[model samples]
Target: MAQQERGNRSRRSILEAAARVFDERGYDAASTNEILASTGLTRGALYHHFPSKEAIASALVAAQSEALVVPDQPVKLQAVIDLTLEFARRLQHDPVLRASVRLAVEQTSFSRPAQTPYEQSNATILDLLRQAREQGEVLPGVDLQEATSTIVGAFTGLQVMSQVYSNRQDLPDRVCALWRFLLPGLATPGMLARLRTAPLPQTAPQAAPQTAP
Candidate 1:
């Protein structure tokens, strides 16, 4: 048990170090030596876990969603909104997630165009929209595919601007604005009125279901 725990810690340390390097320098410029320097681990230890730089990056990209701090919401559409909002909040603090996002978006430098993070994001949003539609939160005629694509594209652009101007300090607000604009067209009138643009308090207050049909 102790050996397994130590191995887990070593793997986490290597990943965290690599994440910071990737976030700062991008994949092409980051090196295992830099990652190892930050980790204070021997070359053999790093190779014992991740075989190569690309493998380390691939692991980060594949596990990006695991870093999200999504909170539960009774409304499916609200859950989708919270997902983005949580990601926005995460960008301010989590180096691991930021590196994963950088690798996913800068696919030209990091890997092939088909990436795990985007695929996972699309799947998550699509599933939420499907549930929201069935619950009558989403408008009857809105195509979920288009809606999902638009939300993802919009968030991508929004976060880039936020990162450029404010280092993502303003992302939560930007995300809320994005949702406020999108909700009018995408949600049913009743649902639109009930949706919130802010993060819920940690201790949620009991309320009626946000679903409307």
Candidate 2:
């Protein structure tokens, strides 16, 4: 058990190091040596953990994609918005993510073939959109494929925009605003109303029935 824990720790260190190195050096320019040096691990250790630099990059991409989805959220448009806002907070805090975005922006031709990590991320997001449709959360007239692609594409564009102005703190807020605009038209009226006009919980407990005293 202890050995397994150590292995996991080592793997995380490598990924974090890769994020930093890749962010600083861009894909073609980034060196395995730099990644290894950043983590203070031996070359052999890195090789054991990841077969190649592309492998590390792919893993990092997968991690970032997974991070985009907030856990335990329902399948409504508002839920997706809430989850994405939370994820944006994470990107704001993590330098690695910031760096990755920079790399993605600069490397306009970094497309992986089919069955790549990015494709997997797309598939997962599409599945969620499909689920929302199945649950009758989206409007009846919405085209499932087009809506999914558009929403994902919008978020991707937002991410790039956020990277451009990352020095400012309002990126996430702006992205949320975009979602608010999109949700009303895309969601069923019930879902839209639930998100827009949902009442806040009355935190102050009502006093127990007052006795005549």
lDDT of each: 0.79, 0.65
Instruction: Name the best candidate (by lDDT).
Output: 1
> After superposition on all CA atoms, what RMSD does each candidate show versus the true structure?
6.6, 10.2
Error of 1 at 189 (Å): 0.5
Q: Write the per-residue lDDT of candidate 1 for residues 104-184, one digit (tens) a residue.
A: 778744546654566678878898899899898988889999999999889878988898899888888899898989999
Record all residue pairs in model 2 with backbone atoms less than 3 Å apart, i.e. clashing.
none
So what's the TM-score on candidate 2?
0.77
Residue runs of model 2 more than 4 Å from their true location after superposition: 68-75, 96-108, 116-118, 196-213
Lowest lDDT 10-residue stretch of candidate 2: 204-213
- Which candidate number would show the highest TM-score if scored against the true structure? 1
Scored against the true structure, residue 110 in model 2 reaches a CA lDDT of: 64
Please give the distance, in angstroms, between residue 132's alpha carbon in candidate 2 and its true position after superposition.
3.2
